[model samples]
Target: MIGALLVMIWLLVAMLLLLRRSQAVEVVPSGSPDEAQIAHHLLLDASPTPLVLVSGTTVRTMNRASRLLFASDDRILPPPSSLFDESATHLRHAGRNWRADRVEVGDRSVVALIDIEAEERTAEARASAEMIQVLGHEMLNGLVPIVSLAECGVAAAEAREGDSALLGEILTTLARRAEGLRRFTEAYRELARLPPPLRLTVSIEEMIDDLARLFASRWPGVHLSIDVQPGLCGEIDRDQMNQAIWALLQNAAEAVEQGGVPSGRIDIRATAGDDVLIIEVADNGPGIPPDCAHTIFRPFYTSKAGGSGIGLSLARQVVQAHGGVLTLLEPFPTTFRAQLPGAAALYGTGSVF
Candidate 1:
């Protein structure tokens, strides 16, 4: 009787276990992976651009292209904000250029990287080639005539006395051409040897006042005005700042003149925040053409026939050297803005460079 009871109890336990297994199987919906999930994985794997998914600081998933484009190690990827927020930001990984954008996938973030190294390198190579070409053309333009005339002068001096007058003329012409070439070369040297700013407390109001007067005297046809807050000052190299501002004003005047507007208007506005000083040099003229905007700041690029194209480029270099930025603003009122950190702000941020 005891043996029979034990068998019945064992059978009851087995039946309970079988029922639980059946319930567990029923809990899971019977289907393949969700279509959306499959499509998402497919999109990431198939994209030629590098893609990586991240959660917090940890990279959760990366496409195959990420391995080929960037380092296999994930630590090199920049934070999502740097990649997504700044449109001008360029990323370098594995000696290649990459640009990234952020995408949302439920609660996670995805970073999509595009390799732009080829395009960037090509642009740099083209610009370098163009610089070489311009240098050759300019040098030959002066040298060829100078050499020919020198040879002619030598022959004339040896051959006859009658050509003395003509020889003198050739010599004078040679001197003039040589002087012009000297100036041209000097400008390039100056650009290359731009001295670091001598940080000194400078009065913005005084600077603008001086600049306004100078512009008014120089460009009689243009109406120049200044609007600067009183007691505004910044720590900058006074001389270099003056030069950069002068270049900006000169460019504005030239643009206005080109637009052929009688009595063209140029407005210089200065304002300072707790951390930065903002200066806007604006003119009422035809704004920069969209196509040439990218190249205008490049060295050796000029739309003006007599322009050396060094002025604006040199000015920008100076501003950059001072840990500031100069950029042309878009839309109407044709403006170029210069943003410089205040002396105290620079010290606070430890961005003195």
Candidate 2:
């Protein structure tokens, strides 16, 4: 919605500039062709959004912003259709998301590209600031007590007259708080330092089975089911993907356990379609709270007691590393989906289904 508004404002500005230029031409009557061309270029270049004028698939011209956007040694722009594929208003290129808007003008079209990724990053920075405040509060909650207890323990040791049991209790509490802080720091470190995926072809069914066994061992009371399309496979980092999927399963099992459902159940399904691998995990348990739907994936955010809150965040990071997305499907039996691209290459050749 914001991208559309920005595009509309820029287009209106361009049209108004053109209208004013036409009026100037009429008033002066002696404006040279070179002067008019320079004015046209200036009008397009003044806007920050990348704009490209194309005649069908051929690139007629583009401003400086567009040139920089589609930077190439030969200075040739890709076809507008290629950049903005049918039904795709969003394009991911050069590690950034662009909102593409194309407008037809006579025999040509003008494509406006807005950097929506910048807006997303701005919002994420805001959220991170808030998370940092919460983190500081949590750290201080643990640290203040630890410091006080350590001081008491030190005074007791120096005086040599303090009760032995009291000193032992103080030292024990200090060790526990320090261990908690260490684990807290370690979870954040894991979330921040996720390595690039080492892609390899693996049978989808086998992976799911392995995960099912692990889940069953961990949550014996929770019934787990797995369904994978026969002969389906994927080119992904096996260990990393397993960790990602296991986190999802763990979350579902924990939700079921917490909800105290009479018969807790988790169903995992995997399918390959349109060169993408889709994995969905659904659980029969209390669904996510409406308020938490937006922030569940944020690191260090959780409602559960003793929850480090890195499970979903780590899962998302792993999927993103494999050039995929992890999203929650709404309005039902609490489902999470992970879609990984390049599934066509991993189908049918290797059996073990």
Evaluated at residue 55, the lDDT of candidate 1 is 69
Residue 123 deviation, candidate 2, in Å?
A: 5.7
Report the lDDT tens digits of candidate 2 across residue range 94-162: 788888787878876677888998888998899789779868987898899999999999998887677
The digit string of per-residue lDDT tens for model 1 on 257-325 reads 998877799999888887688888999988888888888787757888688888788889888888999
TM-score of each: 0.69, 0.73
What is the alpha-carbon RMSD of candidate 1 to the true structure?
A: 8.6
Worst 10 residues of 1 by lDDT: 344-353
lDDT of 2 at 176: 94
Spell out the clash pairs found in candidate 1: none
Deviation from native of the Cα of residue 97 in model 1, angstroms: 11
Cα error, residue 314 of model 2, in Å, equals 0.5
| CA lDDT for candidate 1 | 0.78
